[model samples]
Target: MYIDLHNHYLPAVDDGVLKIEETLLGLKLAIKEKVSTICFTPHIWSGRYNNSPEKLKEVFEKVKEEAKDIKIKLFLGSEVYYSSTIAEDFSKGLYLPLGEKKKFLLVEFASAVMPQGVSDGLYKLMLEGCEPIIAHPERYSYVQKDYECLFDFAKAQIPMQVTTQAIMGMLGRRAHRTAVKLLDEGLVSFIASDAHSPEERPLLFREAVRFLNRRYGYQTAKRLAIDNPKRILEGKSLLPVAGRKGKYSPFQ
Candidate 1:
């Protein structure tokens, strides 16, 4: 079963789907794609949109109840903005937890700039026992400029998720190329729709999986689509080292 650990599925939550109808429509597409499990990651940060834990749980419960007969397992999480207070706030002794009991935090970076002190802050979060999963590295301009920065993140043992839309060239050429490059080099740890809504952004896991299978074979697709995603959902520690230059032996 494929698990999408990063997504903006909650309605009127952040930049995702606006209404309940659109949210359900997006989910229906996900079901058709055969994506067995999906983590509903609404934005939870201090800035503009701050969805509290209670609110998040309530919304997820509502959505899950609505999608009960769809054969897709729904889970709740937050696309957390990795802030300075993340470590303190994420821990059991402190603030609210998001995403798999807060073991995994969907961290998003500034769009244009790949801020300084991120790696150090990541190390601190790790020390606090929180797994930092960077969302959509392929869409980052800095990543487009220098792939090695991503390589550095990968080497730091941070699992990076690739948005399905990026692979589909929905984000544009640079993002598409970066997405492909990451896939070829085994830098991508998971593939998610990042679907805001059915109208705005749609689910294309099946087509993306087909393309990936066609290019890299079935097992490779399974690694990115299934195994690695499972590992992330389970909060498994990432492997040391980085994406290979040649080929990755599937799910080793």
Candidate 2:
């Protein structure tokens, strides 16, 4: 089983599923994908998503209740867009962190540009004892242009979550290439569905696990798809997943 740490399955929360039915459908599909856990991370961007943290939690609770029959774990969280006031906003409890302990925060930058003060902003969050996980660095245009741009983040010990579609080459070539590079260089810490709808994006956990198992070996796939994500929920340090075929030893 796998724990998917990033997804937007809550209806009317953001740009995800619109109805509760779709939410239920997505969860059922996730089961077929071998996902046993999921963290619902709705977008918390100003003006665009603009979802209030409280509202998100309320909807999350309702969805949890509705999906009680489903055999999977669901968590409440938000994918906050990077902004100059992000630290302050986080302090104000405007963003929901991952899992119950509220230690890991999932953050995203604009798809077209990696903000100038991104490193400084993440550093500030770290200083506050909040572990930040960059969402989909592989999808960033800047990162696509220069994959090495992630070196600073890597050195800072910040974790990153790559989308499953990008890893499966369902996205464009640029995104696929960048995702593979990130995994190949050991910069990716988690592989999530980043699923939005039931069909358009849907869940791809099984596909990703299969693809990664073949491309990077079974242990590497397990680390990103299972172990690392479980650590985030438990508020534990993530184990390193250096991507090299036939190099990683089997988990004992």
Candidate 3:
């Protein structure tokens, strides 16, 4: 069963899945894509939405009830923004550390030029027991600026998710190139659509897996599409990956 770890299909809340109609459309798209499980990760950036864990559960139940016939098991989680706004409580707040759903926390950083020490905060969160899965590492201009920053995060041993669009080169050439580089280096841990709307960021796993199989072979592709993602859903220990060949500086 394919499980999509990141998506914004909760409806009428964040910038994604703006209404119930869009939410259902995204769900159907996921079903059509053959994804049996999907985590509804709406934006939990800073105080933008002070939704408590209880509130999250409430919405998850409602969405699941609505999507019952679709046969997709919806999960409870948030796509938290990694910024200074929650710097103090981030270790506890942004990173959803407890519960059996998943010990891994999915976090999205500000962009290439994010505030300094962003990595440090995530590192701290990791030390506190939650593994941080960086959302859309390929889209981060900072990662493109220096492919080594990703290695640095990898060195911290945190798993990173690459957007299917980035790998498809749909987001742009640089992101595509970097994604390829990361995959070649064996640094990528997961591949997700990070899908927002039904049209703009629709499911791209099948296309992504096909590309990975053609370029990197099936074993590597399976690791991204099948293995690592399964570990996330089960909250298991995420294994580390080898860096790309060639002695290179991370800043270069």
lDDT of each: 0.75, 0.88, 0.74
Q: Write the per-residue lDDT of candidate 1 for residues 136-155, one digit (tens) a residue.
A: 88888998988788766766
Tens-digit per-residue lDDT, 152-200, candidate 3: 7766677788888888888999989988888777778878887888898
Candidate 2 contains a number of clashing pairs equal to: 0
Spell out the clash pairs found in candidate 1.
none
By lDDT: ranked, best first: 2, 1, 3
Model 2 lDDT, full chain set: 0.88
Most accurate candidate by lDDT:
2
Minimal lDDT window, size 10, model 2: 243-252
Q: Per-residue alpha-carbon lDDT of model 2 for 79-116, expressed as tens digits?
A: 99999888888888899899878899999998897798
Q: Predicted candidate 1: what Cα RMSD to the true structure?
A: 3.0
TM-score of each: 0.89, 0.96, 0.88
The CA lDDT at 35 in model 2 is 91
36 Cα displacement, candidate 1 (Å): 1.2
lDDT score for residue 241 of model 1 = 18
